[model samples]
Target: MPPDLAIAHDFPLASCNTFGIDARARCYVRIASVAELAAALADPRLAGMPRLLLGGGSNIVLTGDFDGVVLHMAIMGREVLGEEGPDGKFTLVRAAAGENWHALVQWTLAQGLGGLENMSLIPGTVGAAPIQNIGAYGVELKDVLHSVTVYELATGRLRSMAASACRFGYRDSVFKHQDGKGLVIVDVTFALPTAWRANLGYAELAQAVAGAGLGAPGPADISEIVVAIRRRKLPDPALIGNAGSFFKNPVVSKTRCAELLAAFPALVHHAQRDGSEKLAAGWLIDQCGWKGRKLGAAGVYPKQALVLVNNGGATGAEVLALARAITDDVRQRYGVTLEPEPVFV
Candidate 1:
């Protein structure tokens, strides 16, 4: 037999991420399929080690060597599941947990599917997308997610949950907290449309596309514009070691927003549906002069201060220290606590 299971013996995790930070998992397994995942989880060899589920490694800040088994989901598959709501021709596609999220977004747009064009260049995995309900350019994963199938770690049973059942909110979802605490996402289904109008209300996006000589654009056009804007602004994680965004935008009550706005007339905030307002964490960090500031390998990105970079070789602790300092500084200045977007394990 395969000695119960076959896995890489103590693999280095630094190269598996865009962050390029060095760390190691006591044990590591590359799950090529969900069947493989089941086998790995049941392997008696890894009984007591903590389990970690990782995808594209685009949004996490691995702060230390994991004293556990790490399962790298690489299962691959994609299919048009079906059509949906009022538009019989609109489609839904199922994506494997390992599928690159941004590539899938590009695929959908190329197929003339319109729901996810705004989220063009975001990096991560399809499975992880639903966890955070990934959003950009005014569109979020929850907006198009039809359902997600997960493998419960406790019982090894496959359970599928719908969007409403997923409890999706602004960058928050049930998969991220409850119901999915120990359940590992295996695949996700997205509801898409054959044709749709794009939301260009975001000033930067509007400016980018308008400047690109297209007032009203097609699905691909919008994707191109979004990518272009992102390219010009956000530093590529491949070149610079950093998770896409390091902090969650803080949502403050309208009264609090008013208070801050009065103090800083140019305060940037987006009004939420719940009467709260979401403040840009990047803007806040930039205002604090944290942008492009590094201390012994860890630093804030120059253009996108909300993103922290691992410049060459940052120990997990150093990056964490930088992040904690920024959070404290921002809190002391604005009286609003900032939360890190990455899950620290």
Candidate 2:
């Protein structure tokens, strides 16, 4: 190891993950810069060890003690990089990997940017945003992402990948795949529109805007409304340990959705551009009677059926057990297999 590099052994990770599972990492290091990350990865002592690149830890579930190194990304910075495009119709902004995702949204709004408003209050760091292609209300990270700068672990080379290269999907990106294993995100750049318009596409958000009586709402207004809605629907990780929405809204073909809808009239679903229907995972779990229910120390959040919470001193095993029960019930009742949103380590 380099003389300047600091590494801790047997580090407790309960506080690092939102699920609050009392797991420990065999080795841990806080990486603050690209150079530091390179050095740490190149260190012979750390060679051949399994690596976990952790960001805000909001989108993960630690199943047990990690047997390898945990590289906690702490790189931080954010700034407006000025306007771009031939017509200068877009304003570009950049934030380092470890910058709090919600803080970045607010910062952009403060600078009069509007594209990120609908995703307000989404937890996790900027780097994790791309990995999950985090979305909320009516907006997704892919909509505003311009490019991402990453350090390739295998080659020890830095490269800038455009949005097209990220291969974003619903609640997914390239970073979640095998090809993305050693590519550590350093920073992300977004291209916000100069001619901005409020995206009130989501029915609930649109209704909220109407209820708020805003005839002409700006980015901040939409953001405030989104934050309010999330506060009411989701539990705060600080107050109640949770990894936000626990399941991805299952997508079904239009025919399948119609069949299910006919069988169950009260089904909550949204139509996708590709003609599929996105069924609400929360509603499915609620229908399965898991809401506010507990198994051991893990429970489904009372306010949001989609959220699985650590009631108190919950083990990762307990959380997984509760999640499995809920998944099984939903699958049995609805004939749809619900997939967990958080990465399990």
Candidate 3:
């Protein structure tokens, strides 16, 4: 027992992960401070073992037991760094890694911050945002993200990275790279505009706001619309045990999109700026007959084909199996490969 290592053995992890898989960690430690993280990393007992940095556990599926140390990020705080820019139009806010993401969004709204409104009701923690570059509606985290602070486990140093250095992509960032291994995100800083503008570009979001009779929707109004749309589309993890969208919208070349569009005139797709086309994964899954389908206790959500839910007591392996079946079917039928959005642990 090292001075810094408050270790717990055989820690139950069913509740930590949103998928509700009953996995256990061989050793677990909840870190609330830099000193605690540093001490635990230095402990000889954990020196050569594998380590998993867990945040809200919203974006992972624990297929089986983890054989190493689970570093549960519990670091928490939020602060306004400043409200200054050229003519004072920007507000800089910082939140610790372990802060609940949706709670942070609500707090920002309460404080009159406007950038994160489009992403309201998203699950996970602040630290996990950068890794996945979480996005919803028409706005992505990279749109307002300024920088992130990470504790490097490999070198035992803390470093800050700008948004560009994050290498953000569709549901990806530098943290997902091998070069970023052992780096634990500690906090995230956002540069939101003091002068707010509603992002109502996404079709469903735009229509929802309009349907509410809001001719000129503000940030708060837009947030409400987004929340309402998400509630209708996604199942609550508490009640249904889902990790939101199960698959990423697969991007294809313009030629491929054209070919598919010719075959199926009703194919749903969005063109990317890069001349690529992002096909609707949910529609593809639905077309492949996976919507509301089940294998064992794992099943596709009835309303959203993109969601895989634990009907009741579904294991990670069972969920993966269901996912694989859908993936294979979608590829076989549509010639498009569906990639899972959640991390398979």
- Candidates sorted by lDDT, descending order? 2, 3, 1
Quote each prediction's TM-score: 0.95, 0.98, 0.97
Q: Cα deviation of 273 in candidate 2 (Å)?
A: 1.1
Q: Pick the candidate with the highest lDDT.
A: 2
The per-model lDDT (C-alpha) reads: 0.84, 0.92, 0.91
List pairs with backbone clashes in candidate 3.
none
Q: Which stretches of candidate 1 lie over 4 Å from their true place?
A: 1-4, 87-89
In the range 209-281, model 1's lDDT, one tens digit per residue, is: 8888986688888988889878887878888888788888999999999999999888999988889999999
**TM-score: model 2 vs. ground truth:** 0.98
- Residue-level lDDT for 248 in candidate 3: 98
On the 0 to 100 scale, the lDDT of residue 128 in model 1 is 85
Sort the candidates on TM-score, descending order: 2, 3, 1
Q: What is the Cα-based lDDT of residue 5 in candidate 1?
A: 55
Error in Å for residue 178 of model 3: 0.7
Tens digits of lDDT, candidate 3, 1-345: 335568999999988988888899999999998878998888887787788989989999999999999999999999989876798778999999999999999899898889999999999999899999999999999999989998887788899998999999999988899987667999999999988888888888888887899988777888888888889989999899889998999999999999999999999999999999999999999998888989999999999999999999999999999999999998988899999999998
